[model samples]
Target chain A: MAAGAKLDPGKVRGEFPLLAGKRGKGRLVYLDSAATTQKPERVIAAEARFYRESNANVHRGLYDLAGRATEAYEGCRRRVAAFLGADPRGVVITRNATAALNLAALGSARLLGRGDEILVTVMEHHANLVPWIQVAKRTGAALKHIPLDRMGRLDLEALPGLLGPRTRIAALSAASNVLGTIPPLAEIARRAREAGALVVVDAAQAAGRLPLSFEKTGADLLAFSAHKCYGPMGLGFLVGKPEVLERLEPLETGGEMIEAVHMDRASWAEVPRRFEAGTPNVAAAAAFPPALDLLEEIGLDRVRRHEMELTEYALERLSSLEGLEILGPANPEERVGLVSFHDPLVHPHDLATFLDGEGVAVRAGHHCAQPLHRILGIPSSLRASFGIYTVKEDVDALVEGIGKARRYFQG
Target chain B: MNLDDLYRDVVMDHYKNPRGREPLERVDIHAEGANPSCGDEVGLDLQVEEGRILKVGVRGRGCAVSTASGSILAEMVEGLTLEEAGRVARRMKGALKGEVRPGEIDMGDLEALTGVRKFPVRIKCALLPWVTLLEALLEKEKET
Candidate 1:
């Protein structure tokens, strides 16, 4: 496919009903995809169909309705594994990326000890960082943070020095939410492996925007949220090697996960079922396949291409404005899907408010990466993130909005 | 309900050029207030003489609504009796809580921030400076 060719912006935009709604006598320009993607019609319909037709508890029921629900639920697991280039046996559905990371952290508590280290990058969302921090506090393990370079990308060169024999786990995001920089996961995984530390990759931002192959990425564990990938909320997946999962203890223990329960104790079921303690989000899980199909139909490569183009255009336009400082990688090639910038005279909240008045939606505040913000020496920034449905015109509107914000403050 | 009203020209002017930006020297009372949700912070200093209000100053960093509200408040409380300043603070609180409309605010400069009543998320930002003032006054009352 030609660059940005496969996805027809009009057709893709039509698939999202929220886009059709009127906003301030103009079309809604959604630039907050990094927070959560707007769901397509197919995904929404699939969720409705699940509730309308295939609504039943899985695994426990033996009736036709139950069997169908179980099949659909398990089928989603297989599709998610295939999407990440992993085996279905290794995939377990969780609430969201945060829960997935916590599952891994809590399960691995057995392996950690006092003075043992868990390393994470400064650019990690609290979802990835806080769990490890909690794990360290609980297990008496030392929490170490790998430093980010000036561009807000992790420095892989410093990995060796941070990793040691006591390093038990290394968690990092595949893409920085604020910077939009894709990190070198494979190299970091390799180094972590050499140090006998397991690598956990938070692909919440990377999954739908980029092509992710868990096998090739070399991460022992991977987590991503379906809501961020144009699917329904309350559904996410944790993918890992089967053997690694076998070593884990379930963070939650209840009906679905237990094979048999006695008065005293219980034996758990298999890998996925064991991890899924209670009723899974059946409707949301059923909704995921359609979202995956939609992404495949448009093609991820084309989606990435369109986003990169828009990001480059935004960077070029935004940087030219006086008093505007673009954060993250200056080179568009190093970033993906999003751009964050600061207007020295205007706080990000003011900018967001101004843009919201103009019918443009973006994110402000720490973007849940306070350490990175501190390192960048700014309180917060305004971020505009793009997705498959985004068009060049949307970037134009955003650029115009930024100009308006600057003028509003300056004049 | 239009949140843009919160960003009025008068509000922006105070935000851009806040009065009492400097600290009061030999300050009798100092107190800090922070909006944890958005990390907006403000520090207020008071130079009190007996029961009458002598001088009030504020220094802080935050969104326009916050800084402007701080400037308006610093200008309002100075030269008023301590009891009168307390009444103004109560009225400001009532305005923010939606108990009083923008027109009901008798304090001239403080009325500019009345637009903040619409944006619920920004209410805390607008109140951060006033919260610091209250803290400083309470601390001074205890000292005496």
Candidate 2:
């Protein structure tokens, strides 16, 4: 699937009400999809429909409402599992990607031994990095970070040496939220496997855009957020291999996740339910099927191509602007549909403010990756990330807005 | 809101050519404040003599709003009695929240920062240095 695979950017824009709404001067050119995507109509309607029609407790109750609600909720689980090419039994619903990462980290605690090393990269978002830090502190494990090359790609050459026998887990992000670098996951997974370390992939940035099959990906566990994929907020999932998940101790405990409860002790439920405790975000989970439907309708292969084309256009436009320095790889193929940059005369906050006035929404500051910014020797950078609805005209508007910002302060 | 309202020429002037953004050799009180959300930080170096701020020094790297606010704060607090400096910091904080305005007080160059009230998210940026100054004053008072 490529650019013209039955997916029209113009039509896609219309499907999102927020994207369709008019700004004072122009339409809202949302370039902050990396932060959180504007929800499509199908996803929005699916969530509202659940509340309006059948809202009941899932995994409990014998009434018809409960049955309907359970079907809708579990249906989404199966759909998402099939989409990621993982066993439905292994998919555990989460509040967001951060919760999933935390669960993965805490659950893996029993596997870690004193003096073991938890390997990660400097490019990881704080969500992926901090949890491992806590685990290392809790256990006697030592934490090490694989440094990024000057181009912001993981220093793969050093990864082999870093993943020694003492490494128990290698936590890495599938894509850099700041630099947009798509690290070679297969190679890293292979090295981690050879080093006898479990591989945890934070697919928060790469989930819907990339065609990821849990089996083919060679990762023992993967975590991602739904909001970043045009799905409703407050919903995400963690896909773990059954044997690997069985080794993880559940981070949460309460109703629904227990098989038997005594006065003092309890035997937990199976894998997915064991991790999910108490009342889940059922409405949001029900909406996830439609979100996956939207992705399937457009096809992930075409999504990849569409974003690559947009990234290429964005790179070319950004390169032409004076004083703008792009971070990460120069080639669009090496990254996703995002570009982060620093302007010599304009601070990212000032740049974002100016762009906001021009009706272009972009993210600024450290983007929750302060270590990467520190490594880059900058306080903050401006980022513009694309989505399915983004078009060439949107890139043009961004370029025009940058020109206005340059003249506003430096002129 | 217009970008000019937030990034006024005077604000840019202070940002481009900051004043007193260096470490004082003999500091009586030093306090650090950071807007962790944006990774912007402000460190204050104050030298007090006879219950007054003899000198004020500022250090940090941040956006135009933060850097300019720090510069204006460094210039404002020098040679003021500790109580008077506290009053100024309070007034600046009030101005950022729209509870006070430039004409309501003798805020001098800080009047240029009143526009920051419109950008709620950036109000913390404009007030980080002033907050640090207030903390340093409290620390100095505690030491005395």
Candidate 3:
């Protein structure tokens, strides 16, 4: 089920209960994987099974039950590390990608100060952008945007000029949620390294879809949520170099994060535990492996292949509609699995509502990228994103729905 | 609810040909409202004489429901006093949910928005205009 294997989407769709559409189900087409993927029946069962048999707090237990809980939780950490080809010692579990990115930002305070600059792309989702803005504000550092080209690719030519002596952190998204723009992270990482800046990646949208390697990319830190990667929510991780993990501050400073506490001061725990300050989402962590195992079996390369064909067809059909425009790169080779578009004759919200009525689910709005929207000069846009469960029929349904929505609104 | 019920022709009419969008030559009050989640923003300007709204003007960018809601509300409140407009604004929220008492309020053309009732997520869109109108009234109170 790994590389070069052809994935049968119908077979994959059957694995997801919601997508399988049991009794009273209609022609449900889900194209919002960028938001969150539909959990497979096995993934759901794994979570329920955890609660039924292994319901115990992780860490701080000598008994067998606690040992099982700790193993279940730590097992997930190892799996996530192996997924990204990173060191598990540096993986600190957080609530979600936003929390992981926030931890990365807040803890990177030592690397930023007055007159330093934080570089983020214009295509960043608010998850990656807002945190850096806060870091810049807190540290008196300047926040600058790496502008996008007309086709929505990051302007790499201007990056050298931007990566001057003051650049402390280059926060980049491995794949843009809205535009589906995948930047050359390793190249940017190399440049940032030469500039003596730490490279932080937001892979929330790319994790399960790309054959990503944290070590190979040479980025100091990377963050992604499990929910978007076919896993459950309430679980995310910050993967980084073990030494890099030590240098950052922990935003949460209580519970398990402490080593020894006095009335006046306390010592913090080592690496990841220093960052994970509380009892974690063990059930979700236990549930996550099945999802990752499924993707690993199907292969990220296969998933990428499947989504690309659907996306290529979607981009062609969507743009073929009268007055419709695609916001990002039209080439499937240039991006990942999503396509964001707008019809001049219909508002995105109206179109989205109309599409929902037709049983085709998509996301409509800035996709938490208001800055990218401003660059594109659109208030908002509609996005049809693909997942392992997506089929060619779904893309056809999306096209058909948009046509009907336009006629209804124009009438 | 059916899509037709939600996007009634009457509602779409206001969306396509919105009323009260031109800038008022004179203004007594102004307020800007934005629904951050949906990315809808509406600016309201009113010409009031002794509590009666003489003219209503609005500038907006959003979906048909929000634009139409703003247009419909601006037209209905044109000849009404501040207190009456306040009552209408307050009543529209209830009206969206079909919760109006038998003789309590005449929702009139606002009923076109009843289709939005089925979509709990879009309720905010239908209420955006009325919310802004209330904000404008509150600002007037601060001045007085």
Candidate 4:
């Protein structure tokens, strides 16, 4: 199948209300899906319908509305667990990936001690990195970063040397947000396990784009955000082994996350409920199933195949331009559904501004991975991240925009 | 959102051919400023002679807005008294704040960066070098 052919780009485009509106007399080519995927009308309507017709706090009242709300909320948990190929007892819904990672870090802090180390890759998002850093600082544990190779791929050969008796947890991203390189998680997890360390995978960039089976990956905990997967914002999941979840203390405590309350002390609820404190985003939770359904309808293998072709096509076209330096692996198979490049003649901000004028929306900046950018020896770069909905036409428009920018400057 | 507006002819020229691009190995005042938000950073070195900016040089990595802003500031500040440099910095700040027009900025190459006011996210990039210069000046002031 051709790129964007299996999925009707026009029909899919119409599903997003934002795309229906014109910004500057031009079609909106959203290349910043890595930042946040555009929500479909189905997802939006699902959320709105819940609020308009069935609005009630869950797990509180015995009325019909409350019963329906509680069922819907718990039903989302089961759907999310199945989506991650996780057991229902192991899934905990949080505000976002950042919150999920923090919950794991805070809960695991009890097991760590002074001089104990947490191994994380340099390519991790701040959400993953900062929490570990904070945990290390608070516990007097050491944090060691696994460096990437020249092509932005993780150096797994050095894993044996890095992992030691002091290594407690190894956190890594399934796919990099800036460079788009997908690390070899299965191999890394095996190495980490051999060293007696638990593996934490940040699947925020991989969940919807790739096949994510928590069981096969052999990770103790995996965190992912719904916003990046065309689902509603402020909803994400942390899939952990049952034993791992049982060991972690709840990061936040309040209404609904309790088993028994005495005058002075209280016992927390079960695995998923123990982690979810107070009221949750019921509408967002309700919207997730449809988003996953859309992905399922298109099939993830086809999505991956389509994105790879488009990204390869983009890389081939963008690299042909003068003074352009593409970051990350040169081959498409070594990376995910994105490309980050720097123009020697034009700053990324300038390139992005010109692209924006042409109705192309590519992200230009450090992309929240400043440390990795510094390691790569660039200040910032322009990133064109693709998704299931991206097409070859979008790549052509991007190339055209780059050409315009180069000509406007060099001419 | 016009790239031309942000990358004015003069700004691009300075970015292409920046003045004071070398390092001042024997500089007296040196400081670095980093904007962790967008990863724009600058290291500045200044030689103060009799309470005046006798010489200035900067080195770092950032966007065209930042590199050009540094070049423009470097070119305009040389030979000016420390007080005058402070005044110029204030005027540039006012320009960035939209308190003054690009035409009112009399600091030669400095006016090229007046277009940065249009891109709010890039204002920090344009100011990275100037902030480093300010910090260096303040540190020099304290020494005397």
- Per-candidate fnat, comma-separated: 0.27, 0.73, 0.60, 0.67
| TM-score of candidate 3's A chain against the true A chain | 0.98
Write model 1 residue lDDT over B1-144, tens digit each, in one string: 365578887898998898888767767677889776555678887787777767777876788888898888888888887778877888888887788876766758777777776777678878888777777777777887
Docking class of 4: medium
| Per-candidate TM-score against the hidden true structure | 0.94, 0.96, 0.97, 0.93
Tens digits of lDDT, candidate 3, A1-411: 544668889989889989876322366899999999999988999999999998889888888988999999999999999888888998989999999999999888877889999999989989998999998999999988788887889899898789989999999999889889888888988999899899999999889988998887778999999999889989999999999998998899889899999999999998899999989999999999999999988988888888888889988888779888897887897789999987778889889999888888999988999888877878889998999999999999899888888788886
Please write out the lDDT profile of model 2 over residues B63-127, one tens digit for every residue. Answer: 88999999998888899998999988998988887888678888888888888888878888898
Residue B46 displacement in candidate 1 (angstroms): 2.5
Instruction: Give the docking tier of candidate 2.
Output: medium
Worst 10 residues of 1 chain A by lDDT: A1-10
Error of 4 at B135 (Å): 1.7
Runs off by more than 4 Å, candidate 2? A1-7, B21-26, B99-104
Q: List the residue pairs that clash in candidate 1.
A: none
Off by over 4 Å in 4: A1-5, B22-26, B99-112
What DockQ results for candidate 1? Answer: 0.47
Model 3 error, position A60 (Å): 1.7
Error of 4 at A215 (Å): 0.8
TM-score of the B chain in each candidate versus the native B chain: 0.90, 0.94, 0.93, 0.91
Model 3, position A86: C-alpha lDDT score: 87
Weakest 10 consecutive residues of candidate 2 chain B by summed lDDT: B34-43
